[model samples]
Target chain A: MQSTITGKAYVLGDNIDTDQIIPAQYLTFNPAVPEEYQMFGKFALSSVPASQAGLPKGHVPFHTKDEFVSDYRIIVGGKNFGCGSSREHAPIALDAAGIEAVVAEFYARIFFRNAVNGGYLVPFESVNRLCDRICTGDDVKIDVENNLLHNLTTGEQWQLKPLGEVAPIIDAGGVFPYAKKVGMLKV
Target chain B: MPAMTMTEKILGRHAGRDSVQPGDNIWVDADILMTHDVCGPGTIGVFHQHFGKNAKVWDREKVVIIPDHYIFTADAMANRNVDTLRKFVAEQNIKYFYDVGTPRYKGVCHIALPEEGHTRPGEVLFGTDSHTCTAGAFGEFATGIGNTDAGFVMGTGKLWVKVPPTMRFVFHGNLPPYLMAKDLILAVIGDIGCDGATYKAMEFDGDGVYALNIEERMTLCNMVIEAGGKNGVIAPDQVTLDYVNARNASGKKYDVVTTDQGATFCYERVYDVTKLEPVIAKPHSPDNRAYVSEVRGTKLDRAYIGSCTGGKMTDFRAAAGILKGRSVKIDTFVVPATSEIAAGLKSEKLNGQSLEDVFLSAGAKIGQPSCAACLGGPSDTFGRLNGPISCISTTNRNFPGRMGHKEAKVFLASPLTVAASALTGVIADPRDCLQ
Candidate 1:
């Protein structure tokens, strides 16, 4: 795992559930097949409206895109991010779409575990006001070891909760590799 | 030593420790593990890849495999997922593999888990499906996990877990006849919002909770995940013990655990069930709840009753009690949760007519036991939202495009509320329709 990650932020609001991240319809493909697994990246956030014409009168925070943009590597989200189903595909899709880290005020417990165990992305929890300070396409630097995130665009800094026991698992590249390193796997 | 909650006690036992506190990270042995067709194939693949192709499972008998979702779909890819589960179950020599089209096959994994006796008090259970928390009604510490974590549990029978802080919910007074456990839970989720209980164990108990039957308790625990809770637990009582004793096939003695009187909780809430009204979660989110009266007369194109959360016999009975001799004004689909539930609908009767007969005579389409139209099946699925149709569903979620079409709107209610809405062609309060 990188001690510090620098990337552009893709901001999302509260309660961005697994369904919004990747719907159940897109989960029919067999994960054993690499070709099918590769399709998850394209389907990430496919539910977000591509244009505001049909959108009902409400606060719509996501970008208008049918496909995930590879440019944004950090997701800055409000409270309870990844709040629905226990589909690891949400994080898998995000990882495949080149999201290196997620900074949220809070995360659904299962998504947090999935992110850590999958070792595909880093889940950094910041203060509730962190999302208010950051915006889309802003350059952000996450110093994981120091428990801090710096927004270069606004010159604002946010404190991050240290990853404690979860840090080594993420560093070992997911649970399977960590298990192997700690001699949990016999083979 | 500090007093322990039920979740702490269960996890401590599984972790082989004298006691455990909130935020303690420990590796615990799972008492029962589950996987369904949707996530089973991926989990099986991961298990094989990491544990070596020829390695056997840690304990084939301890793992439960059920092909529930995507079983009845015409889509070849969906069918292939079940075929993969069938092949893996046969090869692994699993004892509790429920394959579709078999006499022993049950419908939804969550319902089947308890019905088949995989859940017990004072045990630690995990499943790939998020609603796996439903088994917490049996006084167990149960939660959902991803495919990879499930795969690890399959191979090793153990996984690492962090103890979560406990939140206590106490319900007092008598529950009104018109409202069901679904309404009570919806109110809880609404009060807490979606993220209020994140990473916390929600312990539901009180005089009102003790009054509910096992099935209704299941409904309450099933939606704890909707509020970002790690698990929902109710202490096992005579009602739970009776249900378990009647269903369990292994004859294993259960260690029932309860929270100490002085147990610490991060949060505490109280509700008077008598004062609660029938509630519905409006479109786009389960926590977007409103009173049934608030949305009354809102037009709906269809009404659906089925899913692991709401498709049990008790739910159907409540719906039948309201829909007797009345024909639906809109498209209505009635689905039983399992084959046993389907049989119960056929055998049980109201006014000398079987519940199934009443539904069929009332212009309701009775579908198979699989999770039909709940998770948004293939295009050919019955009762699937095709266009901009508005629906009142008994399913757990009403997320955008969750049932079928992205443009379709969904309102979630109890079986009685759904039946009432079906008769009026709009969202109607069950209390208004009841005699």
Candidate 2:
């Protein structure tokens, strides 16, 4: 929905499942309630082992202690991101934590659908494995229109896979709006 | 029209088309939309937000709310979430609300759906849990979806689906005595990595598959999610029909459909069940496969046999056979998948002793029939791993922090293997005990 999203990248390795994204223990916080929904921000990525919390040099927390919003706005991940559960809380937690877009090699289907259907955040697939290339705390900018990711910190750039068939849905801001726009739902 | 796979045929019929192919995205009517305590309140919120605060559900009978996850916990929010389901069911007049602390309560939705006759052949079923694919054992199109997609289906009995190309897995020989459906599926996931079947349909077939009981068939389909499958299916046979007919209380008729001759599969794999050894998924990932013999004697602090994948009667029977008259060396937790199965533990017997008696006599702890520690609920949850302990479990996942503690290690194996390991306080091969 935005022209470009710019922020520091919090990188992670492959198979960062929903359990690691938002542990099942924190799942009792209902996203329907405003306060409980914000709690997702505080605990986003809380279950990821400290050794794998941040890539390359680990032990980086997504959010500071007791803070609802994260300092980082972008996430770089390897294959099968959000693989474990079908809980939409995975994407909602990342968005609540101030992540604007996630650049991963590929994603598990249900997580991709949840992110796009709920309009939670942009899930962009990079042309190559970017987690190995990008370091945590690297300033990055995602140009949505061009499907390009620029590492402002390293002065490097990479092409991202186009949104393909789901672009219209994401463009219209998720399924409900896309349906109305495509005449599947009455306007 | 060209030949169509079972998945295409099912989606085609629902979409009102004579034929469909892989990559075709069309809206199909949903026969059942199941939600649980974990995702139910969130789905209700989305439904009310988009469809108006007072909007009625598309059809009350089509929506099923099962409160299985996070039940029996002292956590306030977990209890409140069930209350949320109760209120929504009352307001929407939903017909199939399995509330906790009630007679109608069931422990897990995937197992409960078929037991209560909600799963049928040639119908489309959706649930909030990934293991909903377990119902595909009945020749149905069942897959897991998120709250938003579930909410959309709640407001309308229809949702968009992309027809997936089927990958046929044929097993050749009969299952050996040391093997279970868990071993067969683990072999599949091992061959193809965790994301191997992403966005594809997995169909199990052959005489080997047909020989399995209904519960064992459910086990085969339950872990397809681990392979990133959109859905898993099997053509309805006499075994499937017998179970559904006995339980179809509503008297709803279902069509028995099969793959057309010459139907093309995106991929195919054949296994000789007799040749395959018992396997275990090592710590940290489901695809980290190792032969039980290769990892034999690996140290473990506990053993668990419970979940939709491993807590059924068939699983318990297999475990009880190994655990009979043997005292466990480590703490072993045995939780059934549903109350009906739980009751079977009391009524069913091995060597003239009840299954519960066998487990208790083996020094294994029996917990209430819920997803006790498969996903590791509240801190006080029964059998939860609170410290960095190593466990051999029959549950599907062993991802870091999957059970409870972030550093806890989990090795996934079949019930027989887990029982053997429980007796030795290490990962032990079931073949030793079976012989």
> Which candidate gets the maximum DockQ versus the true structure?
2
In candidate 2, clashing pairs total 0
Q: For model 2, what is the alpha-carbon lDDT of residue B250?
A: 79
lDDT of 1 by residue, A36-127 (tens): 77677877766643432112322444334535446778888778888888888888888878889999887899998899997879998885
For residue A80, what is the lDDT in candidate 1?
Answer: 86
DockQ of each: 0.65, 0.80
Candidate 1 on B17-124: residue-level lDDT in tens?
978999998889998889988889888988998888887888988899988877777788888888898888889899998888889899899999989988899988
TM-score of chain A of 2: 0.97
Residue B356's C-alpha lDDT in candidate 2? 99
Q: Using TM-score as the measure, which candidate wins?
A: 2
